[model samples]
Target chain A: MSFTLRFGPVFEAWRELAAGVWLTLQLSASAMLIGLLVAVVCAWAKVFGPRWSGWIVNVYVEVIRNTPFLVQIFFIFFGLPAAGIRLSPDVAALAALVVNVGAYATEIIRAGIQSIHTGQIEAGLALGLRPVQVFRLVIIKPALRAVYPALTSQFILLMLSSSVVSAISADDLTSVANNIQSRTFTSFEVYIVVTLIYLVLSLAFAGAFRAIDRRVFSYPVAR
Target chain B: MTRFPSRRALAGLALSAALAVGLSARPAAAQTVDEIKKKGVLNVGMLVDFPPFGITSLDGKPDGFDADIAKELAKSLGVRANIVPVTGPNRIPYLLTGQVDVLVASLAVTPERAKQVAFSDPYAGIRIVVYGKVGAAVKEPADLKKFAVGVARASTQDVSLSAIAPEGTNIRRFDDDASAVQALLSGQVDVIGAATPVVGEIEKIAPKGAFDTKITLREQVHGIALRPGQDDLMKAVNAFVAQQAASGALNTTFRKWLNTDLPELKKPAI
Candidate 1:
């Protein structure tokens, strides 16, 4: 019933929410860094490895994509302890995010590598380039350029999805918002402030990725 | 360019506008207690899994202390009690939206909560209790200084723990009490802080002696929360509680749901 806008205390709440945003950024960045490593190996396996290896990657992607993120988080954070592998919330949340994002990135990077026509590989061979060099210089870099936009978007989605970790008790922005609302009893206002903070953080992440894209793929390529 | 309005189009627009006005006006008309009684339904909100206090049973029926009270309140008013299941963070929102006429959930009567909703007389007394790892011997709140404590999001226990938490203590929060229990069971945290009944429920769910009881932080009153400005409805509920206490019917209802003897039930605060 008390609808007066308490901007002073509300701003104090926003400050706490800012701290949560920092934690969220830390979670998303680390997950993406680890996810990038997994994506590279998985994409490479699907592209040049044995038939069974490709099937393994396919199953991993399908299973992760099919189940809800909430279930996957519970299985890692709650279910793992029963089998004696107990992990902290930060570690569990990070592992879940990386596994979930890696699957999506695998498909995107695989498509980019596959789109490298047969003639491109043959041309590299004709130029006396080794298989590894051809992969590094031609297949990998250009394919990366082709999928840059998709990868950036996936990372942004990963940032957004990281909000779910609040459920597992990661002291991230959304979880902090819950605490602040309980204290201030300003539920709607608290969520609105948190939403705007996420918007700014997402935009900042997109800008940083754009800068990285320009530095990594200076070559003229498009998909 | 202007499009010509047909007779049928005008009629359709009028009907839709009238429907919108009618739906929006429902809550406004429902402001009075007599109107809510005339509608023959008393909407009540409760969490879906808070056992002994409020819960959605395996058969999908509400089965708990608050659930029983809702039913009794409805019967007293000669209306059906329509229960609205809510989450930890959504209880106040449900009340504000007029989705439920009363929130009979295990809601702590905090000053912050009082600002958003009016509460009837306190029905239950609750305290925040801490449960540490078995054999940890954390005797006091200050004893947790060297260890991490876990709690649920947006809970009274969270508030109490944070207020008196040691400077270097690590306090982790989960979405609900179940997850906090999971963290404690998994050894992710050294202690779990929550309501007393919740700690009891956790013991029932987990292995024997998995957790040891610690200090109680603060005692608080739990009340049936109503939307702000619903004075008449508040008065009616207060009167019913008073009559029930005088007739000893409230005590019977409490024993049936709580399954324990609470001497406090004999004295209805109303």
Candidate 2:
């Protein structure tokens, strides 16, 4: 059967879609920043910190990675309030995304950290660098530079994953499309537009990550 | 302007109904009933996912109150009922664009919807009732002032409750009826605005009389819809509804599927 395409109603509701897109961006951006800190700390502990800290980080990573993102968000948004910790939708979305990405990113960053050679550490130490300076200048920068591509892709996945927060009524792009399609009864048209919008958004995030990588990690190193 | 169109259409409907009474040539557009009779099959559009009102049986045929009604309406038209699956978002478009000859989609008769199609008289329906724990003492809308009530956001219950709730009433809106009912079951909300099907599902697990309907917030009447200007087909559908209501066939369908007597219904005036 041939289906007719209708885009007029979807275009007319640009205001709602714009608001939803703004919220999705804010949620993903906040979660990505906070989650990166979480990953770096956890990865460091897993690599060079006390044995007990590594054990604790291992438990967290395992629990989050084993579970689904939908369940995690549901737990934070609906399940946690019963334990007397109430959170608004936006806050819950941020917490869920951070927790989910934190676990996955921890493993990715840990791989980067493990790739650092013992010789590089010795070189920094012999150069009179303190333990902290040696770790920062010799360990973290190159490790991050090594895994930068993988890390950016994970963040882009997190941005797309932000769409799931709509189940908790967090007013993301998917939820706005749902409301519009229900109202207009133009489901195919509305979803086609939303799919294109999400495609453009993913591409934009990829472009931004590339620019950030080039600018921040431009230092030369001996091969 | 679904509302405005129907108001205007009602005036036009009266003239057409009268003009066709003595005329040999029917309006060219209002000729679906003849085409369907010529084909000897009535293509009835309905939703299969809306349970108790609409569902696909394990046998791969549509079953439920709407499905039963669609079949009976087709029988009256002297044709075999061919059920065409249509979702909530597409049912109206499916009918208007001639993908289906008629719709028995449990379509709620609203002014907004009335502008799109001609509605048969109200045959069967559902209600949004405020129900909760036995001791909550929420016997009416005013009594809801002291308790937190949950309802699916942007649903019929939400609109009805919001329109009448007192200034201090704590009304929580969830994403769906299940979540709203879950909020009630968990004691997260004292009461919920839910439809009969949800209440029926809840009754299967909760203790007898654990929660009861304290007040009915609103009732939505479902009507069989045909493309607008189909005066002859609209008359036939209306007569079928009246016949089913009188013969208790509609109530029998309601009890068979919903396990409750049919909700009282009258032709809505919007």
Candidate 3:
């Protein structure tokens, strides 16, 4: 028996793959930005806000982190329609990604926040800096810098996990690759190309994160 | 530095080499009725997920129309039936690779498949239909425009529906029929491309008259598939099918599972 790899058909459907890649980028980028905001707020609530708000944030994090992303997405896409909350597949996918990453990032950012020295915060306050300013400039800046690597890695994972959104027919990169594989019956070639695309995308993201780290977190820190 | 293959190219080479070795390692052979009888067990491949025709029984055994037929065939051949579960995509490979003597896996007979495996007389049939909510205004394939359709990816329904869907028809392909039906039931898609028995399953769970068959897509016949050159086994299987049809055993099984009389079974012209 002889087997040959035919990548011609896979490359011919480049337009669909390109669209899928674009959607993946859009979903990941938007989810990262919004999820970061969510994580920051939740972290603050857990560490400094009122006890009731902290408890609520704790519940949200536990629920999202405990369940599988596939089930969460299914509940939002399929289960929510019963409550008159029917979201389109792409929107549901984005919502799931945001909710999922937000929880993990909350725990990561919380650890970073706790690592911030109490003396530094007090010194900022004593220098006539307002509470909000002290928290944002003195606490959050260093906290984010300390946890930058973990946060970026989580973002990359969120991008990879976005592939499962195709379960709801969200038409992400993996879904498009599957569609092509089915059409062409060139499963190996299609998957190989998709794997390369994902690898390149991950590297590009990692490189971008590194560039951001050098530019934003370059300030000297006392030992 | 000496020139070397890029890492990407090296990875591609290694993957292709591995796949080539794996694919070529399988030794293909056709099984005769005598060999199966000598072994005292007929390794019959059938699907476990597809309902009515193929399904897992409450006792965790394979039990359905296909399973019954496989057992009857084995009994007629004086051999015990060893039902090995197979999936839609790999049923033919199971037959060709000698993993199973024959496939009663609800595999639809088509010309493309005819080139790969020999098909006996169709033992069962299913009607693929465009089933949907009662209120949808879909009357024909052309009228499917602006409607969101769900189908199991790479299925017969997906292939057939993609053929006639209008330019604006929104077809969402799920991983399998269950998921596609889920999308339709949950209002994720306006309609779905599914088989009659699947629609029957949906009717049991969904409210009465909530959905109906919008349009018939294709009536696909399933055959017992054997490795391409198994003329002797093919004849024996066809004889068994003829005897069963004459005895009304096939119809009885059909009624037990699908609650309907067996439609006239015809060997599709390939």
Candidate 4:
């Protein structure tokens, strides 16, 4: 079972691997940002929009939640081309990730939006805040604060899930590992290294989110 | 304190002995044939959508060279063949984990793979060809350094591409021929290294005059893979191949799948 592991090729491909990690981080960050926006819009629509709009949003979330991410990725990558909507591998993978993550985010954000006490809305109205303004300042911020941890966790999961994009040839971290392992015939070794790198990235993201949480909810500690 | 610890220590020792005995007494896993005979089904792992090798046809049934081989092999063993699709990265894992007995997924017998699994004597010889953009500068393996290359992930073609492709050649690896071709057609890569049939399939999907053939990378033998130490299974497979070759059934099967008469694959010494 023991074999000499080749470190030369892995080291030589360090630049490519770094580029892949950078790409994965960029993809995850961009998708999370865009997914957050989509989540907000969908959550708001469910809470305040017409009955039909709520139904549509619910359907979107349900379908996405029920289906596997692999199938969704396949549909976007393979199905879209037939429908005359083609995207580059990176664009396609990123688009699929955003859509998948946004659905999960929608549920998380909606729960937060619902938890906003009726008293807050009433206070906003009393102060002559417009409906939109009340929703933005009074409801949105506190809801976001309460659900920030869960939402950030989902974002981290999305970052880790970005490994699947390698199937579509996005040249992300896992793809680089695949190439390295095949060349070196050290599949287990390559995966172990990749898992370590992923752990580091996860910790980094967690630290970043903690910093953001402190800055955003700087008013006081809730006892 | 020592007096009380003695009883606890004795209990811990007894527990540890029981655990060790229980673990060691576990039965060894049965072989694929043994399980198949008991269950009355021979499970076969294959590539579900790779034409000419293994594929699930439009009718929702498995077909192709590997599928046919599996069916015949199972019939010889007096068990019904149950086909299961497997991707390249997963095939070996599935075989080792007993998720599938044998992987007839056009698995090439490499020295690296031979360590973890047993391969039947070569039943087919797969030719690796490089398809590049027509009039492209890559007319040979040496030219691959100057051009970007795409290849199916974990395929022999990928190995060849990595070896022959110059440093910084930007070799893009996809999970299948389809995506690799997609990359090539989109100009993401200037060349695609794959099996001859795969290259043919890619050229069909791409624009007119999109593909040009370069040098062949290794047209080595391919074999069905089983878990290592499956001596009985190996002997059975080799016997089947030998029988098929003697009966000229091997050539017929080749023609049925590849749609061409490849005499080289008409069952060599098994």
- Top-DockQ structure, candidate number: 1
Which of the CAPRI classes, incorrect, acceptable, medium or high, describes model 2? Answer: incorrect
What are the clashing pairs of model 2? none
Flag clash pairs in model 3: none
lDDT per residue for candidate 1 within B19-61, as digits (tens), equals 9997785553255678877888888888766767887788988
Query: How well does candidate 2 match the true structure in TM-score terms?
Result: 0.71
Ranked by DockQ from best down, the candidates are: 1, 3, 4, 2
Error of 2 at B174 (Å): 4.5
Fnat by candidate, in order: 0.71, 0.16, 0.55, 0.37
TM-score of each: 0.89, 0.71, 0.85, 0.78
Ranking by TM-score: 1, 3, 4, 2
Candidate 2, lDDT over the whole model: 0.83
RMSD of each: 4.2, 12.1, 5.2, 5.6
**Stretches > 4 Å off in candidate 1:** A221-223, B1-29, B263-270
Better of 1 and 4 by lDDT: 1
Worst 10 residues of 2 chain A by lDDT: A178-187
Docking class for model 1 is medium
The TM-score obtained for chain B by all candidates, in the order given, is 0.84, 0.68, 0.85, 0.84
* TM-score of model 4 (first chain only): 0.96
Task: Give the per-residue lDDT digits (tens) of candidate 4, residues A1-223.
Answer: 1235656667777886898899999999999999999999999999988999899999999999999897788778767777778776799889999999999999999999999889879999999999989988888888999899999999999999999998778889998888776665566567777888899999999999999988987676345
Q: Could you give candidate 3's per-residue lDDT for residues A28-133 as a string of tens digits?
A: 9999999999999999999999999999999999999999999999999989988989999999999999999999999999999999999999999999999999
lDDT of 4 by residue, B148-258 (tens): 688888878888777777777777688877677766766666788878777656656677776778788877677888877778877888999889877988778988777
* Model 3, span B1-270: residue lDDT tens: 899999999999999999999888764433788887788988899988778778889999998989999999999999999999976555665676677888988888877677667899987888999999999888889988868999987677888899999876789988767778889989989899998998888999999989999999999988898887778998999999999888988889889999998887788899
